[model samples]
Target chain A: MKRRNLFIFAVLAALGSGPANAACSFSNEVPIKVLSAAFEAWKSVTDAMAECGNVQASLDQDFRLKQSAAFAANPALYQLGGVANNTIPQLLNEKRIRPLNDLVEKYGQHLKPNQLIKVGGDIVAIAMMVNTQEFAYRKDIFDELGLDVPKTYDQVFEAAEKIRQSGKVDYPLGGMTMSGWNMALEWLNVYASLAGDSFLNADGTPNFNNENGIKALELLKRASEYMDPEYLVSDSTFVQQQMQQGKIAMANIWASRAGAADNEAESKVVGKIYTAASPLAAEDARPVAMLFWDGIVIPRNISDEAAEAAFRVAMEGLDTEMVQAHNDDAVWLIEGYKPGRLAEGAVATASAQPSPISYPMTIEMGLIHSAIGNQISGFFTGAKSAEAALRAAEEEYGTAAREAGLLQ
Target chain B: MRFRTFAAFVAPSLLLMVLFIAAPLTSVFVQSFFVTQPQIQRVETERCTAGFLEQQCTTEIKNVPVLDENGAVVTTTRFVGLDNYRAVVRPDRAFAALSAWDWQALMSIDFWKALRFTLTFTLVTLPLVVGLGLAIALAVNNTMRSIRGPVIFVSLLPFIVTPVIGALSIRWLFVGDGILTRAMEAWSGTEIAMFAQGWTIELLMLFYRVWHVAPFAFVIFYAGLQTMNRETLEAAMVDGASRFERLRYVIVPHLMPLIVFVSLIHLMDAYRVFEEVVGFRSQAHVISLQWLTYDLLQPDDAGNRAVSRASASAMLTMIGIVILLVPLLRKSWRDHKGAR
Candidate 1:
């Protein structure tokens, strides 16, 4: 089987300008679980890894649940899996995935120093790509309206109001405030940047019901008014569709989804969409964005031999050859990744911001997110006041924290 | 049969029940009385960069039950009796809210919120499911024999569809700019966002529940209708009873047992609602007790689960089901006794 795969790989390499120095080879089989959206990128790596080893990729958007369940139920079922940045903290704390420091030193010669996911003093995962939410707008509409690129949330509102009054677009903005998880992340993005480093204080008590919390809630509610009437149901796809159909002029959406805006088949306003850094909440505030890394983790319960094979396959998949081949699909962390036409906006967005902080991966942050996801929508719908919403959020967070033993 | 033979014959089923049902139920009950929280320990390590003379140390908090030779946690689960129940029920908070007459705040607790929706969903959908099911059963029964088979098949289609799919299909029809949504907008000349608010979502969920579940009741009633006494129905007609009166007095009385059966089944099923919340993505506005338990069992950001809380929620839901089933069980028991 190994010889057959190597033969197939050599033929494919001959057919395409495959990696000339494809030296790594293995006989073991490795099964990978990853998000379906990143399948194209994974496909390149899997195919490349096939030359040396048997590699299988299981594509699922519910990778978090799958990874956790697989590790809990039967870790040997999979050898390698990917997890989002926000999910890393849980995976690390649970010790479901073993420390990759030894493996990295042994097998990751081509890996960059910055790509290592260090929790405490040990490397646990190696990030393949970076993803974050950023400002995306219709450049043509901005030019026609003579609107300057919005640098602050106030400017964004002004532009939205002008666009709304001009009747150029049905909705001036798009939002991903779908009631639960997405909305929670949206609140986190705005609050964490505007309010400061953390939602909890040093002692892990609830601390978001302050002036900053109220302001963030008010800003969210105000910004929501300019979005689709069904903003509460609007997720990334809905907002993307709104942009595609020319219903909205601008949005803060994931950089990973920016390429979809220019897909001519699904878009009416193709080439009109442009991406930039997220609008600031205050004059000197951090950009209202959260950086996320998509990385692979090998469960600790898997056989050492399997883990080694999985690590080797993963490294081969994330090598320079694979990155250059599928760089357009994501903002790659690998070396030799040149930003393509589709990635130009995300590149500009990332470079423009002062290195956005990752979404905090602590359990308290997750609980705080649950609070925001559950209660903050009340403020948006006028069911509760901003102050009341903030208070409710704090109350929920406190209860959850105490219950989870994160606080006294 | 001899007593020993009877016991031997029943032993397998009893053993199976003890292993599968009784054991898990007992475990969940036991788990409800306990709570599991992260076990943390602080460790100090000295750092000497150049020499031992200039040494510094730092202390860090670690999640551990007991540290191994390599400082890895060997065990993390810690048991706290009754704390899981306390956390979910929050007796102190509930009392505070009640004493203060803060009804809104009282409903803010997750358990209370989920319980409110679960009860509302079950109670509201119960009668509608029964009535609609009976109505459809009668309509199909009255149809000509040639079309009866096809009519019954069409009536069964809703129940035949997967529950999640059925709920999702209904949800999409009413969600933003869906076909029905657009039609409503056009007819009313006003935009509608059916999923934006809790009440609207609840109404939609109730409607979906009826649409999806009524067929089961209908099939049962229709089968019962076939076994109705023809002579009694004819006698009722000859005695000048109207169609409504015949249905009310004769048919309903005859089908009371089947109606009870359907009600018992619906109560048990509806009280444990989970799929609809997920299908409609309505957790933002509405949640059910089963969903709450499932949500608790979900891995936190640290990969560990709220197992004790989930177990407590399961126990509470089971108790609710048992409470709802008591009267029906009592009625059946009385019927059995009277029949004997």
Candidate 2:
């Protein structure tokens, strides 16, 4: 009788292990097409999904803009696609993506409630990750210099200057000021926090030509002094390289790229980099970091059956098991996500700042973002004054707004 | 052959041309006259009464667009002929700025900025490309036969490269700690950002266009050299005409037709100028007419494309191309008439 009981226990344990191993797998019935950004987190998740069934993912470096055009032109080409938070309003306004409420009710029982992106009472997207620009620094260098983490933009400048004077590094600050979209975003991140409201006024006019705008531009220019001389061409990748190669002491970069600091293959200063919330502009102002969420959406033009299958695959891809396995790949918004070793810095960074604000998603806001990129180069190159740049930005935005039919 | 037989022989080519070229052009022309309106739908909202702890709100679903007659959604394309054209040209704003003598403001407009760059890029690069191509062709033509093959092969490499790839290669050489950039910095003891300002970026773009495109002109000029009259060259030489004089009076006149051909192709190709902007990432400083059209086609925050504006820009670019080519086309027509 004891032998029989032992055999029964063994059989039950084996059966239990089998289900857990194959739990997420489904039949390869329908082919699901996905368009996503070419990032490690997305790659790992998509690789997991591809194990379950038939999936073809087109991962691109510029997937956000490309997917928008793809969905607009031929939505049927993809059953599901990933888009950034700032792009959501436009896709929603165009009615290109379907409400995912029914799919959520059916297959999204495991999805977190906060991850459901609702627009006007309709569930449109299921967010997979939370992305934000956070402040990063060399902890070892800061400790060596007997410095504390900066809490405001002024403090950051002081820290950068101290580091520069110490003769420890060539430039203490690295920037993402590649003109056009990158530079525009920097202006927005600084000014939006200083303005403490929407980019536009209540009456839908351009509103960044005041004191706040000039101050933001001045602060940006001041920060440029301690940065690499080629900061105008510097982008996120350039900043990341600077940190990894120990060329700079601190920068506010996307949290998604923070993992590279600890990557032994790419980093010369491994285990030395730390992260904290982005610096503030003033005592009363908010954090200067820009908040963005990237998630998956199903275009409306595909068949319902296809949509259902695509959602199932995406859900399994974003399931708890996958998140746990690839937790360091991103700051996940899924269940079973505990801050990994690398994310400790990111968590500290986030907690130190004031509550974050979402990047503006209005069409008018997009127009302004582009207009600022076009006009701010003048100021950077000394072809225009701070006030002149602000005026030009406002005028350019006004013209774009009028052309987009957002203004008369 | 009978007229009917001759017509039958030309019918297929004409049909293909009409289907492929004329139809798309016509569609673009018509699309410029119409605009797509965004679809607006009513959404429910809630109002709450103020209270100490929390406001108790009652939800009421209302059809926002349905109730307001003037706010009705536009369901069909509307024809606003010439509106898109006006937006592309911005004539009123330009005129006002010009009246005020605000030259800066007038050039600040997107259309004017793009047009200025496009025109400058095309007109400035035209002569350099022609001169360089003719020079290379003359050099290769007079070379020893044994070395001619290798020289020709090596010279055609630049032209053989894809345009975007060539531009990117050149950009990488001079951008941010790149080999050439570092070398220059080391030598000059000063930093250089080649893509920083408008003039520098424009100069780099001009250099890249000449480098990448001169080889095509070289091959054409070289091939034209093979068919030149050796007897005329001998006569010019016997008359004690120098090599430069021989080239100026004999070879150039002979290569004029090919020069015209290459210039026409280059003008049309360079006037559009899309790939260089993309490869160099110069949209912050330099933009072309074709790039403006592409920028318009990009969907805005509403996911709605500016189709009418793109169409209008495209039409304007085509008009610019036609204007630039008018002299050459007229010369060709006159030459053909003289030949008859």
TM-score of the first chain alone, every candidate: 0.89, 0.91
Fnat: each model in turn = 0.22, 0.14
Clashing pairs in 2: A90-B301, A276-A349, A277-A349
User: How much of the true contact map at the interface does candidate 1 reproduce, as a fraction?
Assistant: 0.22
Each predicted complex: what DockQ?
0.24, 0.19
What tens digits encode model 1's per-residue C-alpha lDDT throughout A1-408?
768666655654653434533545555445443332245555565566655534445666666666755675454467777776677666666567888888998999777776776655667777777777778888988999899989889999999999999898888999888987788888888886786556777676777788888888888889888987678878888888888999999998887777787787899988888777788888877778766667787888877877887788788778887777677778887888887655655555555545445665555667777777778876776656777777877877776666666667
Best by TM-score: 1
lDDT of 1 by residue, B1-340 (tens): 9999999999999999999999999988887776555555443322111100111122334333333554354544556787778877888878998999987667767788789999999999999999999999999989899999889999898988999998889888998778999999999999788887788889988998999999999999999999999999999999999999999999999999999999999999999999999988877677899998998787655454677888988998999999999999899889889989
Among these predicted structures, which one has the highest lDDT? 2
After superposition on all C-alphas, the RMSD of every candidate to the true structure, in Å, is 5.1, 7.0
Question: TM-scores across all candidates?
Answer: 0.89, 0.87
State the C-alpha lDDT per candidate: 0.76, 0.78
lDDT of 2 by residue, B1-340 (tens): 9999999999999999999999999999999898765433445554222111122233533222122343223444778889889877889889998899987776667788899999999999999999999999988988999999999999989988999998899889988668999899999999887876678889999999999899999999999999999999999999999989998999999988899999999999999899899888887677888989988787654354578889999999999999999999999889889989
Over 4 Å off, model 2: A1-30, A61-79, A94-110, A299-309, A340-353, A361-363, A386-405, B39-76, B96-103
**For residues A127-155, what per-residue lDDT tens digits would candidate 2 score against the true structure?**
88777777889998999999999989889
